[model samples]
Target: MTDQIVPDSEHRGLVARLPQVPRDLAQLARFDRPIGWWLLFWPCAFGLWLAGAGWQIGLLLWLLLGAVAMRGAGCVYNDIVDADLDRQVARTAVRPVASGRISQTLAWAWLGALCAVGLIVLFQLRWQAQVVALASLALVAAYPFMKRITWWPQAWLGLVFSWGAPVGWIALRGDNWEVLAALYAGCVLWVIGYDTIYALQDREDDALVGIRSSALRLGGRVRGGVTVFYLGALALWGLAFWLLRADWVALLALVPAALHLGWQVASLDPADPANPLERFRANRWAGALVAAACYVVGNA
Candidate 1:
């Protein structure tokens, strides 16, 4: 009944209508906040499109399902690990696990169900892609502890979230390792940038709880930090395009996404509570623009 369940839950009305257990589970998995899955899904699409498999709707659909399930699973795992910490933070205090609305045993069961779906998605991919996807498990497992140990947990997240790039590339063809590296690195910087914006919502709370984040680390200079990361993302993505096609026109495809990132940085207002979340949520569109650019270059 409170926003504490999720700060940016989009389908609150629908979620409110669900049964208590289902609602709690939905809240736990963040189904009401679809942006998490959207963010996860985009890199999968980016790698697929940029690897010349953009037209493989079947594969893309499978990856989307995988993203939804895996992102949910990751959140559940994170909440389980951070329940104590979440209780100390305003934004996450009412989460199912943190607030005791859902027991950890049940939460673990929920996690298993989500991972089951992820497993189904995994079986749909080729062995090389499957291996690439599975390699992320260790990263995922270690991510919840990063904030405790490092100021750059977002960097760890960048690696985990952007694993889809290589998976997509390897799914179609195993060659061209440089292009995949560049694309994956670009996605990593993009994750760091957008996630820094998302972290702004929790900076004050994070600091109080001793949780480190790029938002808290950058303090007043978060906007500038984001600008630098976004610029780096564009540069690396351009490098990926050039490596693949070596055409000036191929680089032009990134212009739309570049302008969009510029707008995000220009309009960013970290002091305003709403601005960071709005800018953060807008990245679904940014991801789409980047994917389109990838398609133009990779499939041209």
Candidate 2:
């Protein structure tokens, strides 16, 4: 109900499932962070709608289900890999695994269960969408390690998170590769932009812990870097719409989301951590606006 981020006091309910559930294991899935699932689900829906798959309500529901299960699964996988690092980060210190609430073995079991649900949803997709969905496994598997290897792991996350756009497009159209690619690329940049903002919250903690992230790498240039990513998102998304519909009005659909991102960049304050997190969370709205634009343009 409240839009607060994952660590909120009320969010404890997410891990409150049972005397049955090991408290540590419950936390590992980040059941408290439903926003993660919502963020993941929306893109898939946007892709389905943009591809004119709105007629298939059943497919949309299944895709939504897939997003929830898979996002949870992804988080589990991520926690398993980052248990030690997460303990080092201020924000992640309370996480089930990092806090010793859950064991690695139990975490793996939870992951398998989440993936089973994901597989059920996967079977509902067309073969192309299924393959597309499955292809992301490697990307997802590798993501937790990316932060260890590169400052730009957010870019990698964008690819993993945005894979839904292409699969959604192909699920209906079988393959509008160019349009899908543009959307996917735009989403990658968008993730980079937003995640950089999120990374700001952990910049000090991350650095102290010996972790690497764009938030630390960008340093004073955080604003400029995010601006580039946001602007690039606008351009690519505009192109995606143009190629799909070839109309000026269709291009106009991106205006609102563009303006939103503009406001975010314009008001950004590098000295203040709150500003970035606010901007990062507001991206849910940005994604919605783009989805609407895509739908109007694609259906027009």
Best by TM-score: 1
- Residue pairs with colliding backbones in model 1 are none
Q: Where is model 2 more than 4 Å wrong at Cα?
A: 1-26
Q: On residues 1-300, what C-alpha lDDT tens digit does candidate 1 reach at each position? A: 555447678888899888888999999999999898998999888889898855899999999999999999999999999999999988788899999989999999999999999999999999999999999999999999999999999999999989988988888999989999999999999999999999999988898889999988898899899999999999999999999988898999999999999999999998899998999999999999999998888888
Please list the residue runs of candidate 1 whose C-alpha ends up more than 4 Å from where it truly belongs after superposition: 2-4
Give the CA lDDT, 0 to 100, for residue 129 in model 2: 83
Window of ten residues with lowest summed lDDT in model 2? 1-10
Q: For model 1, what is the alpha-carbon lDDT of residue 63?
A: 97
Q: What's the count of clashing pairs in each model shown?
A: 0, 2
